[model samples]
Target: MQEAAHTGVSEKSTIAPRKVLRHSVRGQILDALRAALVDGELAPGEIYSGPALGERFGVSATPVREAMQQLALEGAVECLPNRGFRVLTRTPRALAELAEVRALLEVPVMLRLARTLPASVWDSLRPAAAATADAAVVGDLPGYADADRAFHRAVLSLAGNEQLLQVAEDLHRRSQWPLPGAPRVRRADLVADAAEHVALLEALVAGDLAVVESLVREHFAGAAV
Candidate 1:
């Protein structure tokens, strides 16, 4: 029952979904851990035991361990054989490299799609863009992250390259994890970033390739989760 885990568990509201789904306990815990990572609840370099987290979440240590293993696969945590799991520290250089890679993979595809995809396709993503904005207004980092990814996924799916889309998404998720010594994320920052989705969609629908390209690059430049 370390204080850090208690603090993380107390702020679990940031990770809780509005509506409960049919996810298994392990699946649910996995989502919760990811959200916690995004919100900086899981402090970098801190080791948390599965049994302790399981006790807090009211489940067996087995489920928590399973979830932690999944996170380890995602590079979010490292397993400590005789202890627990340690959240990995992400450096500025690493984060910047990820953003650059995302731009490299997504920008060209999105720019090309802007020219050919019908306005209707862009219009369909409006709801997701709006959802991100709404989540930001309430400082719901986890919700904003989910909505943001959904919007990007919708746009990239148009390229009909499932593998590319999946790889970009994995990078995007890692980008959202809070960096050590980073200032607490502000509501204004979230709102501005969320608005980029709307702006990008507008540019796509209006057939403004230059604006779309600029917006896409700008989006990655500030892709600060």
Candidate 2:
């Protein structure tokens, strides 16, 4: 009976680790899929098979399918029965709408922060702001996306509202999605956007609310376009 008990305990221990490993693999695959989507490697409106993606990633199809399901839930893809996941074609109008909503949600908060947060606070954000510019210079879409979001999160976190930060981040991600049948994002565009980050930071540091508001509105308008 003791031997049986020991065997059962070992089995339970093994099961939990296996579950964790699967979850880890799924998370890794999901991140890769998101990177692919942002990089324009997975073209919009193109259907990608789990088996094929698995081959590319050197894994089995199960994790790829799981990751694709998550993307589907995020409205990034659509599942086709007996087929695979199709990357959704994002329209400019959809992007504009998302940008409009994001501006509404974030501009007021940013303006408030500009009024309240001191120069030291804005100065402290320079490194994160610079990271976005660095990534943009190299045309690293995935790097830029991560850095851009991180910079925004750093600025917004000053408001101390976790819920608002999360919502704004989601909107920001949606805005960055590659448009249908479009080539990769222009290096010029990324540079221009990255410049706005620097401009906004400077405006905030100088306590110039008018410049801040203008920059913020122009930033979102550029994002929408």
Candidate 3:
């Protein structure tokens, strides 16, 4: 999926308005499905019909099928001939492998950023951090997921490397896919993750590389998501 960069798309950025009209419908449906996967509304291993999902999202089956096809390319789902798609299930071993990838990518960069970036750089992320906390307090898993993604993206943006951000962002999304047979998210877990972001930012501002590294490792170590 390294070629994903070839599309010249930053998942979070603004797009041309004309292009938005043509692409946003399918893209939005894809995003909604991704959130459903992470939020467990689309349970892993379940075969879901495009028409059925279209009914759920109030869209036509054509767009839903297109979106699911994109997700299938991302390895999030598998297409069945003449049928719908099946949500790909991730085992604990798979989750652990993903966590290891994230730790390798995120930890060292955070340590480097903590020492080099200015206090205001970390301060710039406070709004995303606050947004994460607000979503966590409300026990909104999808909301927290978005906010958490933004917060980490903001952090990695400081690296001045779009490729790094994109790669890490992809792994981050994969890591967040809901575990098969996992329990619903606990409010306490979201709150704890929010607190970790806060501390991570504080460490970044303090230029405490050790604390920043520790927090980054611990954050990925708890892989309930």
Candidate 4:
């Protein structure tokens, strides 16, 4: 009789487990650092040391160093020759340009999604937008920021185009700049934004692609201003 074939898991399964662990570690570090940078907890021009960050994150320096290198590659942080990592600061002009790019990329995708996706997806976005409005009302900037990200993500997800979603995400990250000494999201602005979302939802429900696109463009323009 032929020798019994091995019944154990394949080598690929063993290697895959380690790969997943490493990826999770790296992703955790990156997300924590990115949140700090965006929320102004890590100020512009502040130099970050790997050891310090590693300690703070309860990890060793290796993962933190890897994360910083990845961030530098993404242009979110700059590596000094001998010093450390510095967060990249965006100028007003640069922010405006990024906003324009975001509008161009996102609005069209949202419009297409609105016209094509099922109404249920649009309905699901309402709660996220309402939460964003509530956060703004309570002066919870971080909460508002989280909700804002969710709202946009929901809209992009409806597009059903992975490539376009990736492009929009890249643009969104680049658009995070200090708001010229203004609050990140003021109560009034939040209210207006919520209204705009409602209008977009109404247009989507009506299958009015033209109105949806116009509203999206106007919303971005208002935010950019």
Q: Name the top lDDT candidate.
A: 1
Clashing pairs in 1: none
User: What's every prediction's RMSD, in angstroms?
Assistant: 3.9, 10.7, 9.2, 13.3
Q: lDDT by residue for model 1 over 47-163, one digit each (tens)?
A: 777876776677778988999999999999999875788899999899999999999999999888888889888988899899999999999888888988888888888899989
lDDT of 2 by residue, 1-225 (tens): 133243321111111111224447889888778777788777777777777677567778899899999999888989886667788999879988998898899989998889888999999999998998999899888889989999989989999999998898888887878887777788888888899999999998898999999999998888512
lDDT of 4 by residue, 69-133 (tens): 99887778887654457767768788888888888788767766776788776877788778767
* Model 1 bad stretches (over 4 Å): 1-23
* Candidate 4 local Cα displacement, residue 150, angstroms: 2.8
Descending-TM-score candidate ranking: 1, 3, 2, 4
Give the CA lDDT, 0 to 100, for residue 126 in model 3. Answer: 82
Using Cα atoms with residue i matched to residue i, what is each candidate's TM-score against the true structure?
0.90, 0.86, 0.87, 0.74
- Angstrom error at residue 108, model 3: 0.9
How displaced is residue 114 in candidate 3, in Å?
Answer: 1.1
Any residue pairs clashing in model 2, and if so which?
none
Sort the candidates on lDDT, descending order: 1, 2, 3, 4
Worst window of 10 by summed lDDT in candidate 1: 9-18
**Model 4: per-residue Cα lDDT at residue 117:** 84
Which lDDT value does model 3 have at 16?
18
Q: Clashing residue pairs in candidate 4, if any?
A: none
* lDDT for model 2: 0.81
